[model samples]
Target: MKITVRQEKAIDFEDITLLNDIAFGQEHEGLLVERLRKKTPFVKALSRVAVFENSIVGHILFYPVKIVNELTEYESLALAPMSVIPELQNMEIGSQLVKDGLETAKNLGFKSVIVLGHKDFYPRFGFSPAVNWKIKAPFEVPDEVFMAIELLPGGLMAVSGTVLYPIEFNM
Candidate 1:
């Protein structure tokens, strides 16, 4: 089967919703995707979908984020709620979507990307524990699961703080 990863278009919204719903077997993630789309920080160009045989099989989204400390807030991106059709879970569709999304984000001039994801899975993509950089999540989650990757050299070296996820993520 041939696969292509690309930025999601306006017409792919419903299909993406379905893919997220089926992949997670619930409405929470799917709803978050929908709500996030309407938020101010939503980056249309960074949202991506994996297509195979003319069907969308996977989805990923990166939202504009701020790493804020007592001194200041640093701009960044956050990866959230990535999903793939369950039947194709191990086929790398999600990976391709992530790789494509991150590359697009970097090209768009994002400095760093944060993710609250599987420790093992995200590490393969060059993500390291955000704690190492002195960053913390807004909520209490395992340190190992909160990860970040610098798109530009020294991106995270100078910036370390709490990630402020969009209100939609908290809602």
Candidate 2:
């Protein structure tokens, strides 16, 4: 199996949307991703595709998320709505995408990363509850559902209160 990761381009938009449908059964996460891209132009497309002999079959996106308290603003990241084609589910493509996103985020100087996802899956990447960093989502979620990984020491230090998503997230 030969697989590669690359930055997404405008041309890949249609194939990527199709791949997302096959991965998640039509337009759910696609909306979020597209909305983010339109609204958060600064988002990094550390996003990747697993090309298996030509057809695009997997995808992921990373976006800017922030922790805002009365006196502080911390730049962080959010991993939302990742999906792989159902047929590709067990093939480690999702794992590769997550690992690639995290590694790229670290190398780019992002301090902390947050994800609202499967508690069981994310911990494999060292994600702990955001509460550990005194951070909470605007909406109430179980402690484990909101997870974070601090890429640097004190990355989340003294960071507390609501975690705000980009306005485009619509959440």
Candidate 3:
């Protein structure tokens, strides 16, 4: 199926929330999305939806998070709660949303992005274990699943610290 990816609009909220709930088979992720939408660091340009046959089939959101090392806190994006309609898993919609979101993040001057996600899935997008950059997840997690990508050349090479995710993520 042909898919088009574009920035999410206000009209897409209900569909996006429904897409997340249906994709995850739960309400938690959808609620998280709504909460994130209301907070600072919500990058509307980086939030995207995948459309097929005039309907939203997938959605992705990127928001700001901090990587604190001693006195300095570096800004970065976090990829979380990305979802596609369960019936269409592996149909390339999720991949397209990820690729587009990453591009948007880079263009917007983000130095890096972090994701606590599938070890097998995120690598294809150039993510590697955060440990490689001396970065760690805020909470304990398998190193392989806590990943980071440098948007700027060498952006993450010198960075080392714990990520600080927004509180809404814990909801």
Q: What lDDT would each prediction earn against the true structure?
A: 0.90, 0.79, 0.91
TM-score of each: 0.97, 0.91, 0.97
Candidate 1 vs candidate 3: which has greater lDDT?
A: 3
Q: Tell how far residue 145 is off in model 2, in angstroms.
A: 0.9
> Per-residue alpha-carbon lDDT of model 1 for 36-155, expressed as tens digits?
998887888888998999999999999998999999999999998899999999988888888888899999999899999999999998999999899999999999999999997998
**RMSD values, in order shown:** 0.9, 1.7, 0.8
User: Candidate 3 on 69-93: residue-level lDDT in tens?
Assistant: 8868888889988999988988888
- Candidate 2 ranges with C-alpha deviation above 4 Å: none
Task: Give me candidate 1's TM-score against the actual structure.
Answer: 0.97
Candidate 2, TM-score vs. the true structure? 0.91
Ranking by lDDT: 3, 1, 2
For candidate 1, the per-residue lDDT at 42 reads 84
lDDT of candidate 2 over 1-171, digit per residue (tens): 777776678878788877776677867667667777777445645566666777677788878877888897788888876777787688888888888888888888888899999999999988999998889999979998999998887888888878888766664
* Runs in model 3 lying further than 4 Å from the true structure: none
> Which residue ranges in model 1 land beyond 4 Å of their true spot?
none
* Candidate 2 local Cα displacement, residue 24, angstroms: 2.2
